[model samples]
Target: MVIEWLTLMVPADWHERFIAADTAIWTHFLAQQPGYVGKQIWRNPAKPDELTLLIHWQSRQQWKAIAPTALAAVEQEFRQNLGRSFDIIAANEYQPLADGSISSQRPMAD
Candidate 1:
């Protein structure tokens, strides 16, 4: 399985709004994507703007095949609806460990 990780930083003052937006994205947007196994969102207390997303996929090829269409829809949500509220960082795709543990031992692509 492959996991797609995305980190987003939103203005501290817009935290509530961003959270609500993420709810919509996850439920309305991501839930409909093909090969989407599951996802989790994390909040960083130390850095109010920090948001982390972990998305599970059946395979890299499946993700790649549907990403263009899936991301375009998401991009519209970010740019048209929530653009002014946050800064988006790039996403990282990693090959999960055989044991299904997200430990430091998980190999990251170079």
Candidate 2:
């Protein structure tokens, strides 16, 4: 499996809206994709302005296969409709342990 990790800076006032839009993108858009497994969002307790997102996919190949054009469209819609709520501070992708399916233990937990 593959995981997409993102750290973002979001204003406290926009937190709820930001999460809602982010959730919509994952549930309505990414979830419809061929390799999408699930996604998780988190807020930093010490830093209210900070947020994190983790998105899981069946494979890096299928995850990367998502067309940039389609992704751009979804992002554009998010910005146009929800307005800018956060700025991504960091983003990365990784493949799970080669040993076995460890993530299968807890599919999508807090």
Candidate 3:
């Protein structure tokens, strides 16, 4: 399985709106995509402005195969719904290892 991890920074005042729009837009869209397993949104009280999304897919190829245009459309809709842009603090992809641990391989520098 492949896990797509995304961390975004959103204002505290916008948390409720952000979660609503995200669930309404992203979760609904992702549910229709092939190889989409599930998703979870998380928050930490110490860092209320940060939201973490864990998107599960059957395989990395299936997730990456999603069309760029489709992704762009969804993103545009999300921004429009929120009436603002969000900052993605970090993005990473991980795969589950045989030992029941998740591992992310970083790209080598040139």
Q: What is the lDDT of candidate 1?
A: 0.75
Error of 3 at 17 (Å): 0.8
Whichever of 1 and 3 has more lDDT, that candidate is 3
Candidate 2: tens digits of C-alpha lDDT, residues 1-110: 88999998987788888888877764589999999999888888999898888999999898989999999999888887686635889999987775546865655677
Residues 1-110, candidate 1: write the lDDT tens digits.
89998888866777777767777775467667678788887878997778888888898887788667667768677656766645668689988666655673657799
Stronger candidate by TM-score (1 vs 2): 2
Model 1 alpha-carbon drift over 4 Å, by segment: 67-70, 83-85, 100-110
Q: Which portions of model 2 show Cα errors greater than 4 Å? A: 98-110
lDDT of 3 by residue, 1-110 (tens): 99999999987888899989999999999999999999998997999999999999999999999999999999999999988899999999999875433455555699
TM-score of each: 0.72, 0.82, 0.86
- Residue 49 of candidate 3: its Cα lDDT? 92
TM-score for candidate 1, residues paired by index = 0.72
RMSD of each: 6.6, 5.9, 8.2
Local distance difference test values of all predictions, in order: 0.75, 0.84, 0.93
- Candidate maximizing lDDT: 3
Error at 70, model 2, angstroms = 0.3
